[model samples]
Target: MNTTSHTVAVLGAGTMGSGIACVMARAGHRTLLFDVDETNLGRGLDTVRGFFDNGVRKGKIDAAQADSAVANLSGTTDLGDLAPADVVVEAIFEDLDLKKETFGRLDGIVSERTLFHTNTSTLSVTGIASGSRLPGRVVGTHYCNPAPLMKLVEVADGRHTEGWAHDATLEFLDTLGKTSVVTKDRPGFIVNRFLIPWENSCIDALESGVGTKESIDAAVRGALGHPMGPFRLLDIVGMDIHKQVAMRLYEQLREPRFFPPPMVERMVAAGDLGRKTGRGFYEYDDNRLFGS
Candidate 1:
């Protein structure tokens, strides 16, 4: 868990994984981004490149700095290629059994000292770690969506996670210029615990005809001073992902507020998966919300 001179491997080359890899590379780590599919790995690499390109355009980073950061990132389709990493962060789908199976497989490939971090917002860190051979080394480093821009990184300790692992994760996040908050291994950590329920309530409101999606979003933004309303946030989070998270939290806590509303499930079933799918509670075109 030395912050300096570490090789980091990020599994799953989706939005979160790509953003996490970009953050690590920008922080001067030699980062390897991996996905089972070559196309996904390619797309993840493209996302990292796009982030750097945008940084340069915005004057947040100079050309040389962006170039160096981009150079620090590499992609691989082979999980075996991750053995050289000092730390491995899994940013895959938010399925408990899938995460456990992934860690179980990695246990045979990675070194005993290689710290395992799961970027899960809802699943139990203890459950994921229990499948690992080095359970004490497994920690939760839940980065907010769009990891490169978001400053908060929630670090959680699993039931078997060692103190050093927790400390090291905080230190690592600090090196990446992220604010790390320590929380117990629980459903939704902290932000999602409050945020997801609120989102579900918003959906409920929409279904009950209390407000139009845009009107509700505007009301929350104007009245509550939230940058984005719950519906907009759900769109950003993806309807499918929101449903999964709500379902998991509901299953764990049995709270009605955590249950996904019927509209959410219907939208997900319709493949209107927010920005990624061009529609959700709202429609989108070329990543921009339609008409705004």
Candidate 2:
């Protein structure tokens, strides 16, 4: 699909969803961002606005461009509003049943030509598509966290995904100035295949008193030239999400290294969900990391 001339509907209004909406809008597509509640939809819009504002401040985009992107972006509380979309991307929670249910509902609402994409990082695209009326139209378009800044989107072809659907998704993402890698429908895909295991190891080390979070993060930063250490990345990704992904990968790959450590479970159980919740492996005040 030529997304430039079409409308893109993004389901869910969380961080990833809102950020993906910004990317679509900025790419000159009329983007409809949908959520179940008014507050989440409003928050998603605000996040898009904030991204544009920051882009202008950083000279990444001019005020005119920002205005145009914002003009192209709209928020909706009704699933029915997405019927007119040419492409629908689901950025809901990481649960398989929930994703399948969402896609099943969307099948009834959207046109058969409307391409269905899921922003699932670990779940099977084939499994999600199995619940859809048109499984051949479903594909996985997994955008990394903070989608507006992340340039790489993992495109996965499910067992039933048609060649045209996969090709069109790649073309659409390319038009959005995103680099994509095609991967078979598998747990964790490429980036997470390497990332989740490393993170699991980092948690194990932390739990074993290998080093303090600060020292370990600093060592990785200074020695390995990493942008952020595993712990900090885990915190940013949300400890609960980290644990969930780890468990999923472990279950599928049966790799001991992918298992979520006890510390991660305890932290998630404690409701320390990282930046969003103001606590996780580290403490945050207003989303700013204050202490370990």
The deviation in Å at residue 70 for candidate 2 is 2.1
Error of 2 at 174 (Å): 0.5
In the range 222-271, model 2's lDDT, one tens digit per residue, is 99998777777777677877888888888889989898878888888889
Go through the candidates in order and give each one's C-alpha lDDT.
0.85, 0.85
Q: Model 1 off-target regions past 4 Å?
A: 209-211, 222-225, 285-292
Off by over 4 Å in 2: 287-292
- Candidate 1 global TM-score: 0.90
**RMSD for each of the candidates:** 2.7, 2.8
TM-scores for all candidates: the values are 0.90, 0.90
Q: Which residue pairs clash in candidate 2?
A: none
RMSD of 2: 2.8
